[model samples]
Target: MSPRPSSPTIPEGRDSDGVDFRNVVGILARRRNWVFGVPLALCALVVAYLLVAHPAYTGTAQVFVDPRDQYTPKDDPLQNSVPGDGLLLVESQLKIITSNEVLNRVIEQMNLQNDPEFNGERVGLGRLVKALIGLGKPEDRALVTLRNLRKKVTTRRIDRSFVIDILASADTAPRAAALANAVATSYLEEQAGANSAFQRRTSEAISAQLGKLRQEVKRGEEAVAAYKAANNLVGARSRMVSEQQLDEANTQLTNAKTRLADAQARVRLIETIEHGDAGLDAVPEAMQSAAIVQLRGRLADASREEAQLAQIDGPNHPALQAARAQVRDVQAAIQRELKTIARSVRNTYASERTNVQTLQANFDALKTQSQANEKLLVPLRELERKAESSRIVYESFLAKAKTAEERQGIDTTNIRLISRATTPENKSWPPAMIMLAAAIFAGLTIGIALALARDYFDRQDRGPEPDAVAEPDVPARAAAEPAPAFRPAVIAQHHAGRLSALSEDLLAAPQGHTMVLVQVQRAAWLDDVALQLARAVIANEMDVMLVDADLARHRTTSRLGFDKAPGLRDVMAGIAAINEVVQLHKPTAMRIVPVGLSAVAERDPRARQALSLAFRQLRDFDRVIVDGGEMGSTASEFGLYYLADEVVFLAQGPGGKSEDAAILVDLLKLRQVKARVVFVEPDVSVAA
Candidate 1:
């Protein structure tokens, strides 16, 4: 049995495959010089760039926010105090600063519009000189000139600050400073103009409103006066007094008529009683006097009773009738008394009538006086109405006049600057230093990446040593010890011994030599049948020399473990003795000869010579097995046909076409080689 191959031991303090941090570090450390050098070169390049770049002179000017001129307090009635930020006003001011109005003013003041520096046309002093010397075109000079112009002017705002810095660069420092100052002055002037315009508009509006209000006051006064005059309304107090007087007079007249009617009624009542028909005037003497007096007394008593009865009862009552009977009797006496008194009363009535007429005349005079006073009140009422209307007008106008006066005097001092712009001495662009630093950083990063990539692509093997004597399809396993080296001549000796044994088995048959089986590998098809035939002949105890004749792509000899042997080529070339080339294995009783070194077999004529000599020597053995190279090669067919006793054509099953095999047989027949062809199918067990 062949000795098993040994296994390699892995070192501790390393990965399972023997890789370690030290190995990785070694790779990077080897490349450290490049990594450091690359970054340093980048930094040097940055420095060189900075040195070659144009030096710009930036001139700046400072301007105060000018609280009174730029920012004005908002007049919002709902607000009590001014807003501190006034963002809208600040934004408007910023617009004015950058506006064409300010820019145009700056351009005019500095003679910038016509100056080549600000003109859209390009021009340069260097190009102009070159043109004068006939070295440059005028248009090219103009472009250079514009480029220089663009470098001179710059403007930007400070970070979130109210300051806007205007910068100008020029060949001379003074011009740059002058340009910046001119821009700032122009901006200031623009601000002043804007404020003046706004104030003028406000003043004009207020003056117009004041004039209209004054006219309105005059018209309102006239209207109020007209209303009062039309209505004839005096003062409220005078109207009330007139109404009270009329009411008093009406009451007095009503009372006087009531009294006159009652007095007249009393007079008529007395007259009616006096003229009644019953007469008691003649019965009133002493006895007549006694009787008449008594009658008179009774009559007086009856009259009193009638007066009481009238108060207590209606005239139709029975009690009232008794009273009336007495009253009739008393009325007869009263009629005598009244008739006597009536004459005197009629005379008195005539005198009273005159008095009544006199009283009525007095009342008529009082009425006339009251009418005259009411008539006199009308003009007074008109005058009072005029006075009231004039007073209303005066009051309303007085309020307006007071408001206007207050507005005129109100102080505008609350408008003040909240923030001031400061002058900036340095420019805010082309941050070269930071850019250089970033470039250096990027170079270092690239260097590291390149190092890692280089390590990945190189395919050299690394780690622990391999264990097996032969590297097989599977990984190597541990064995007790290694196998011994093989000899070259042992293969031929084993073939000679196997041929002697086969000669013994064939003694009964005409004492002739046994049939030799010579198998060859073919190209266009794999030769599993050849391998199986070799195994079967060996099982029969016949001598078999398995000659691997595949000279191109030497696969068969390598598969048989005779890759290191020298055989057919040595004998063909006469370089080595025959016994030294063939190799034998005693344990399997198998002799095998590989086609000699790979170089000899590639030359077609030499390969054919080698095959012919090797086949001629095979007659010494009982039976020889030849692995001819693929049928595709002419050399394998020529050499094998001349040498073999009987050729066994081996083919792979499920192999492509049988044309090569059939053609080989026909070719052998044409040559009249003494050989019988036998087709062998590939054995399934051996193939698997």
Candidate 2:
């Protein structure tokens, strides 16, 4: 056996595949015409479209939406029960702007059905295409045209405002503006017509109600008149007669009673004065009499003259006697006047008592008559109240009816055409440079997708992968020879330089050791590489043990033509001993282990330990080469890497997927496994 050398360190430059700028440049350079031509062609087509395309002009008209005030009842309790927000009303009006009724009117007024552009029957590329496809039918053409016309006319409500912008587009500058203005005007006319009709109907209803109310008022007044006539009550004063007479009677009775009380008091005073207990000066009536006052004055003069005579004249003098006689005559006159006044007061007292009795009797009779009249007037008063209420209602309805009739003649609309649409100054669509740029970008994207798709399909139809099928009849001597002799012509030429470089380093590796060949990429061709390495070891006259560790697809075993042979899988599963699966290569005379179909070998807990023990048994051979399919792709492959002395990772080239290999390398390093990477280029010679 040869002495084993120290483990080899993979050079940093050769650790994993790196980016090859040359490869990308070669791809683009090979398809240079396609890369440049597609975008330019598309840009030219777009420029042609912009130049020759029919330019459309857009026109806009602005209209204001004014919400009409809803008639609110002044005394109704339910006026606020429903939603009356003007926002909702405004929104409703906005919807009505685009309604079928309004649009139909606009269409009729503009005579748009005869217009080819609005009817969708205009001569154009789309129409020609549809004609060729036999799609345009005459029966549905009107509907289709109407639908298309509606699309051209759009109404937009200004944000947070009640203004709406009506936009219309057409082939001609004036037509676009005309259509916009026509739609707005038609909407306004429709609203006004609707309001006028409503007012007319309302006026008719009010007139009918007013007629009924007038009849009711007339009937009520007639009934009240008849009631008065039937009771012989005349004039407006008739109803108030009983009440007025009772009031007057009460007043008269009260005055007469006052007079009677005064008269009685006067009579008492007169009687007292006449009895001589009190003087007649105490009588109010006598004092008030001018005759009594005159008599008293005369008596006062006589008393004074008498007092003078008594003071100055002799006892029997003639002047003294005459003064005495004058005083006596004045006293007699005053007494006679007081007695006459007292008798007249008594007569007035009796007369006043009789008058008070008559007034009291009249008041009582008037009160009785008023109470009876009040009872008779109860139903009449109710009829009067009803008549008054009906009259008021009738007057209100008459006023309302007059107003509605006046409004019916007047045309009014809440919507106003604040601004009319005008002829467009410039084309609204197909900005030349911008459209050209977009077309160029789209063309480039489409070109790239086509290129990638062509490449993918070409690869798919390029027959099966060279390494996908296993070779069951290749002689062992073919593998032991140089790559050109046994490998396929495609692989030999492409991998010649890489295999040559790898051979020198691999041949210098120490003998009597295990080598694990693992492919980190999915569905790789690492097994073929392992076969070549095994053959090379055998060529050195060493006893090589080639173990087909990949049980899933026994590529090595197939190449060796030992499918029926017991192999490593049997030994791992404890179904067969290690010695039982070992066989010698036909031409190379090297020991080989075929992969047998053994179930549960992967799930065996002691599979790794058993594989390690199997490796130890293989130590007697000059070298052991295990084919581990893919490292992360299979779980059983990890045990082979642990059992091997050195691991070779085969990576596919021309891709930036080194991260996957790097992760595997890190994992292997953690397990204390030494790994080296070998990059195999698929189209290396073609690229070159």
Candidate 3:
């Protein structure tokens, strides 16, 4: 027969034979309806909708915004749209195409106010219900139609390109195509109208400036004419009268000074000749005289005749005397002519000096008059410059105004339609394959979550399964001494089933120390039950310890064959350590701490604190079963009661009226402990 038996404990999972996959499969199989049901219903609805719903048609049109075509007619800069803004122009035109101004044009042209899809008008019961609830304020019919048109019409620019696509959706194909084309036409018309209006405004702006500029030019010219008259600045050929007179005076004065200088030089030369410092011929005045030349010629002829006669005849010769007399006569004539030429030069020099003084006076007067006229001309010249500037500006404005007027009739928007919309053959929404796939995915996700959630909650509702752990046999104790008032064989054999249940409840947790207050008067009974509970806990693979806390008699110490062992009391009194006093029972592998021989457990004031320290240290063991003796009058001795996880009140008969035990139970509320009480009645036949 097997020595080990089964005891009740909590189990972790299913039986060892079952795998995790099967366990999960069983849990989900129970909730198959949720896992498969939702997707089927959603798919059925989608299929029915695809069959019954109206088949929608989408029409598409393409517009090309030709930025390269500036279309500027004149020099007016505003004639062309912002062509330099390439990508920016495309984006701005997108907004303009969607604006109310363009959409209203389309609505009026196509008469979309009467179209059912665009009008968004509700009739019958739905309108009445909305009116009663005030869902939205009543709006103009045109506004509602415009809003619906805006919603149905879609516009997008092709990727990094100059083409824009306009899409419109409707119930029928023809109406959809017409709607798309109308929107494109409306946008182009809006752009053209914008250009025409801008040209007109520009013409008006330039005209507004023309009159003011003209007035400015007129005022400038008049001021220049008035200034010229006031300052006496009239002139000929762009020069003042004083300026011409000053030029003539300066010329005459310069010529007079030159003639005077020449006359003075000639007069000085004649005086030098008269003083014999120079010859008469050496002076130009003398050399230019006719009388001096003729006299010198006659002297030269007579001297030549005398030289020939002196060579031919003696000193008394007639021709030589005649030549001497002729030479003296010619010298007298030459001297007379030289004096006449000198007088003529002095007179000429005097006349030239007088002429120079008169001309100098005239030139000075003309210079003063000319300088005064030049000062007056400064303001007149400034006024003339202002008049010229005003005329130039007026002409510029006049040119701009003419250009603006000419361009008013011409439209220069470069946007044009490239492709017209065609009737679509297929609907855009409610794709059957995609909806079916989505429905399946959603159903699987929801079903799996619900199945797992239900399984988890069911497991929580049922309690945990009990573990099949081995139970220790309460074998008969071999004793050499006679037994006390408590019989171990009787209680161990008959009360084990009942005591095992109590021990399981008290020691549910397999870790830490549990001080169980056993209110039994008999010391032998404490030893038997503490040993029984400890041995039972050991079968579950735990370390169990026992402490004999009965102070008056150390009977449990002796029964466990540790009569001479130093124990908890000696450790409390500082006589022996807990390790030296503790004894192990070899048969059950149970450990015990018996009361020592030299210490008193009843009267020590520090006994409770020292014992609490001892219990706190014993938490290293899995279960420490404390054999607290019977309840006494003082709570100071029963301090372990506060630390106990439970209280097993063993009385031997019907539970006795022990007020000490009741008071101890009441005081346990200080620690807020929910103590488990197990009342035991001794079986008389088993005891006998």
Candidate 4:
């Protein structure tokens, strides 16, 4: 048995196939013309475009809508649009700034309808291309000019701010600046007009309401007057006449009652004096009389004289009688005065009572007239209140109209210009640097893809792989697994130079089979030689198989890691089929048929016929290499030698000069099997 050679160790970051980075670098180098030419061509095209294209200048103007006041309710038109959202308000204003109403004014002011840059009247390469493609005008000439101008003008708001930016493009810097300024001015004027109109509408509305209120005030005042006249109500100093008279009558009634009470009391006093048993001394009139006073003095003297006489004489005395008569006379006189005083008092009381009664009757009549007038005063007071309210409302509306008119004249500025457009110093169209960079990037991507595609086709055009790879007859499960015990091409290619002559010495198929027999003869490199020879034959564009039919030793099978696998012995003993036993190596594209269970050839009488039948099944391959056991005296020791048309003897082993190999060689000569001796140096690498 021989030992297999050690495999080369793979470097880090590189596979057994090749280095990935080197493969990429190599592909670029091989297709260098494409890689460089494409980018240069694209750069040239960009340069040509930048040179021939029109150079347009851009001018920018900024207009600020004072967010504090622009969104206020003072202007109904602007306020009603995009309410409560500040950001949306600014965005909507940007749209309004670019609207047709504003842009049309700019067009008229700037005479853009006749400008070549905006009017579509100028001829250019783009226009010529469009014309060639039948892109004729679809509207009137002035309409086309307006559409073109609109395309050249754009409006946008600054982020998170109320400032709007207006941009215009033109063939000349001054024209561009003029167009931008015109557009800005037009937008500001439109906003101002909208605000003015809103103010005017407000004033008109106030005036209309004022007129209605004035009519209401007049009607309310008229209603109060009509109510007063209809009920016969009269007033002096804003007071009813009947009410005044009733007040005066009430005062008089109060005085009359007092007077009547005093008079009745006086009358009662007189009657009480007359009916009572009291004397005229209690009477006031009697006390004030001079006649009673004089008679009282005379009666007092007579009573004194009579008392003196009555004590001295009897009832017939003349002096006593005379004194009694005088007393009687005085008493009667006093009685008559008392009666007169009573009559005078009674007359005075009666006069006062009559006057009080008359005044009470007059007061009662005044009260009834005042009560009727009071009932009519209710509606009259309500009408007065309404008239006062209507007058106040009319004055308020009138004041509001005046205030709105004043505001409309003063607050006409809705937008202010933050920045005016200036003549640009450089062209904006056909950006040279950016275009060149983009062109270079695109060219590199396309060039790399095309190069890779061409390289893939070039590899595909080469011849197909050997039969071992073309028709892999492996099991379904083993399709994912790597080839069994297959050595890399690194080892095969390393040994290819030493085995080149040996590959030529391998005999072609004589008539029916391309089977070549090899006798190891104690060669330590038996497995290595057989593998290298098979790989070399495959590289020569031939399908080849290496068979380890040396059943006694099974060196190739043991070293190739398939010693117990089904092989020639299994095929010859009816244990396995030839297709099932053949092993295909992926890395070297070498097929090897291993020897298994050699005892079958010795014990089974039909083993020879089975072996011949197996060899016949393998006739489709271009070449078959059989590893016979060490050389021996009898041809029976090398069972596959009889089937082979050629035999190779390894000269490095003792069996090459032994008597047994000599006898076998002569027998091979007699059978006319072409035989040769190959001297192979022993391999230095240890088998894994």
Best by lDDT: 2
Candidate 1 residue lDDT tens string, 253-318: 666666556555545655554466633242222223344556667877777877888888988988
Q: Deviation in angstroms for 18 in model 1?
A: 14
TM-score of each: 0.34, 0.58, 0.52, 0.47
RMSD of candidates 1 onward, in order: 26.6, 12.5, 17.9, 20.8
In order, what lDDT does every prediction score? 0.51, 0.70, 0.70, 0.68
- CA lDDT, candidate 3, residue 208: 97
What is the lDDT ranking, best to worst?
A: 2, 3, 4, 1
In the predicted model 4, the residue pairs found to clash are 633-660
Kindly report which residue stretches of model 1 are placed more than 4 angstroms away from their true locations once superposed.
1-53, 66-81, 120-173, 208-215, 235-432, 450-688
Model 4 alpha-carbon drift over 4 Å, by segment = 1-18, 70-85, 216-397, 412-414, 457-688
lDDT of 4 at 399: 75
Sequence-dependent TM-score of model 3: 0.52
* Model 4 TM-score relative to the real fold: 0.47
**Backbone clash pairs in model 1 (N, Cα, C under 3 Å; residues 3+ apart or in different chains), count:** 18
Scored by lDDT, model 2 comes in at 0.70
Pull out the clashing pairs in model 3: 9-467
Model 3 misplacement above 4 A: 1-30, 48-52, 66-85, 121-139, 235-382, 454-688
lDDT of 3 by residue, 1-688 (tens): 1222111221333122121234346556667897888788888888988886666678999999976545544544454445565888887788888899989998999998987667766454556787899885767889999998888888899997999999988778898899899999999888888888998899899899989999999999899778777877667526777888889899999999999999998887777766886677787766777887788899899888888888999888876887889998998888878777777778889988998988998998888888888888888778778888999999988887887788777766678899999988877665678889998999888888888787556434222322221123445444333433234444454445547666676467646647565653342333356666776788777788888876655545666667687887787776766777788777667788987776544545466556656776776777777766654422225355554555555545432233333444554444454443345543321210
